[model samples]
Target: MKAILKQHEEHKRELEQLNDHWENSARYLEYTKQELEERLYHAEESAILIKEELDEISIQKEIEIQRLKDEIKDLRQEISFLSSSQVNNHRVKELEDALNKAMREQMEFKEKLRIAKEQSEGGNGEVTEVTTTVRVIVKVRPFLDSDPAGPQCLMCNDTEVQIESKKVGSAKCFMFEKVIGPDDSIDELFMDLESNIVHAANGGNSCILAYGQTGSGKTYTMNGVISRSLNKLKQRFDCESVMISLQIIEIYNEQVKNLLTNDPLSRDWKDILNLSEIQLGNNWVSKAQDLIKKSCHKRQTKSTDSN
Candidate 1:
């Protein structure tokens, strides 16, 4: 039947989207790994330079200690030879004081080198990496064909987004990590986010929520992102051993309904008391889109506010 083929086509599209998302994620992770490696390399080089400077200072200290020891030894020999002829007590005392001062200076220099070495070798001679914070980004999708193309309220720059109010004659600006314009592709949107997705795929749980007012392109944007994430997971795991599950949930008027259910006519909230018990197993992909269509149809015609 035509319906069966259409359902099959939808599944294929879902799989394709998943594959693309995952591929993008893998690429992003590889790029991040390279960046970290580069940063570590530079840190190591800097550590080496610091060690070299400290070693130079240590070498200078050794040379000075040797010079001072040699001078003290010569002075001692001279004092000993003069002792038999009644050398001046004041001169002998001054020479002894100078020798003691040199020894003290040598010990102070060695102590400085010890402290310097301890600091330079904090992480097995590797400098600790700096931690980075998560950044929020905002993106605006392109206007649809039916929408008017003219000056809009939204404004975006590299680091912020501004929305102007015509009635209030004022603008509100929100700071973000990055801002994507309407002309940007979904790939551009996920360019920086793929690393996080890849991380999540490797047993790390991640939640991506698409939230906005009605008809704000939230579904469109999230669909693209979710598809990409699934694609990346495919690459990381074996196809034979891995199983992917999809469940679409619809909640209306404070009542929850599984959009991937068998009975498309199960829209009455009174029929189900506890929404928490609704569970669609891993095999819901077949009727997911069709059930969503039926749910939408019921919502538009029925008055959910009434009994």
Candidate 2:
């Protein structure tokens, strides 16, 4: 009976141990599952935070883009408003209207001149007075020949044109129907420029100009002549006493630009003339003449105070 009681106690102890082992394993598995669930919850929360940050950045970028667009629109509107304003609009209209009127008047004057010429040449009822017309023929050879340069005009070919003056002064004006010379050579056009300088310096103003189509070499001719003339003057005279300051300007898009400087601003070309005339104590017949004179003398022709 003692042995049986001991065996039953041992069996009960083993069964309790098995039950405790199973309970411990199940508790451990439940703990692992809860830990996994907590980790998953934390990962989801992190993803939500990251998405919120990206959304905020995207919103800021969109706001910036909208602001920039508004700024650009405002700037365009302001430009349009300023462009439509008076200074540009009214002045252009006035100039156009004045030009049209001048053209009509010029046509009328030409018709009147034609009528006057016809009336004067036609025989009228008046005391007949005879004026003797002397026809003196003289022959002169041109410095340049026609074959080497160009053909002479048909009208002047039969006539023996005489040299009225060999010494052509700078200020003295002459009219040529057409000038023949090599395309970019100033020496041919103003052959007597150096010879005429002394005469010009004496009392008269020298004016050498060119008028032609844009590509026909107006600018080239004028530039060559002006540059050559100045160079000649500098070589002949003391630079300190007779220097030529050059001011190059351009009228572009109906506005004056100072080519010498970087400023694309319009200057009153009248101011230069006014100051020059004030210094010389002379009244200008016109503003343009004064400007021309001022430019010629602007390089300091003479010192204000001479020792």
Candidate 3:
């Protein structure tokens, strides 16, 4: 009986020891498993965070690419605009060149035509020679007032000279001193010289002058005669085969002034008087001499035919 009880107690102690060891082993295993699960969970969380960061970076890269694309598009538009402008500028230059070429050709054609016409007529060419003559005409002042409504002459105190006469003719000399008076009628003065203007018109030159004091109706008479005569001549003698050259010069003080000077008040005596200094650049007068020659030749031919 004592042996059995001792055996039982030893067995009981062995069983308790085995139970405690088993329990400790199980607890250690559970702790190791929990640590591994915690590590795995933390790794999963880190991976998720990395994925989110990568997604954000990808989005930023896409946005940067889009912005660059927009910049490229704007640059392309600017380049296109500049190219179009360059083309237009080239086209305008071509047009201007064509126009200038056309004008030059036209002028050359006109000169050729004139030369041909002049060559056709020959022999009795004395009538073709351009003759220059100085002429004068005297007429009464139409307006009796000095300043429109004001009556009476300011300087002379005369009650306006009667319309004595008007003469149109060629003079053998340049200067004519007081050949007319205030009381001569136009018909009476023009008796012998009425037909003389016709001869002068055929290629001869004439000058009619009125010289006197400032308020002596010089301006009135000169302007009136010039206006009426020029209008008549332009209308009557402007045929293509006939050419008339008219020059109106004003002599102030001792200097001859050009009627067409750019500066009216330019007081330089040399500039006013020197016809050689006159700049007729690109004007119709550039071909004037040729035109005159052609007209004179035509006139000479016509006169010979008539005779």
Off by over 4 Å in 1: 1-43, 46-135, 144-149, 264-307
Write candidate 1's Cα lDDT for 1-307 as tens digits: 9999999999999999999999999999999999999999999999889888877876786677557556755665666666757878888788778766765665565456445555655634322222234557677765554654433767776588787876668899888777766645566566546656755656665566666566657766876776666566556665446455544555665555554444443456555434424333444333334444454444423433221
| Predictions in order: lDDT | 0.62, 0.45, 0.45
| Candidate 3 lDDT over residue span 1-307, tens digit each | 9999999999999999999999999999999999999999999898667656655654554455344334433443454465667766665555555544543443344334333333334222122332334344434333332334321221111123222212423322222312333322233234223224445565454445566644556644544444444444445554454544433344445545454433343457575555523332233233444443333332211222212
Which candidate has the top score in lDDT?
1
lDDT of 1 at 34: 100
Off by over 4 Å in 2: 1-178, 182-184, 265-307
Model 1's C-alpha root-mean-square deviation from the true structure amounts to 35.5
1-307 per-residue lDDT for model 2 (tens digits): 9999999999999999999999999999999999999999998898667556655654554455344334433443444455566457655555555544543443344334333333344423221222322222211222233233221321121222222333553223333433332211244344434434544544445444455433344544555566566555555565455324334455544455554334443556554333322221222123233454444332222333311
Candidate 3 to truth, TM: 0.28
Each prediction's total of clashing residue pairs, residues at least 3 apart in sequence or on different chains, is: 6, 0, 9
Worst 10 residues of 2 by lDDT: 132-141
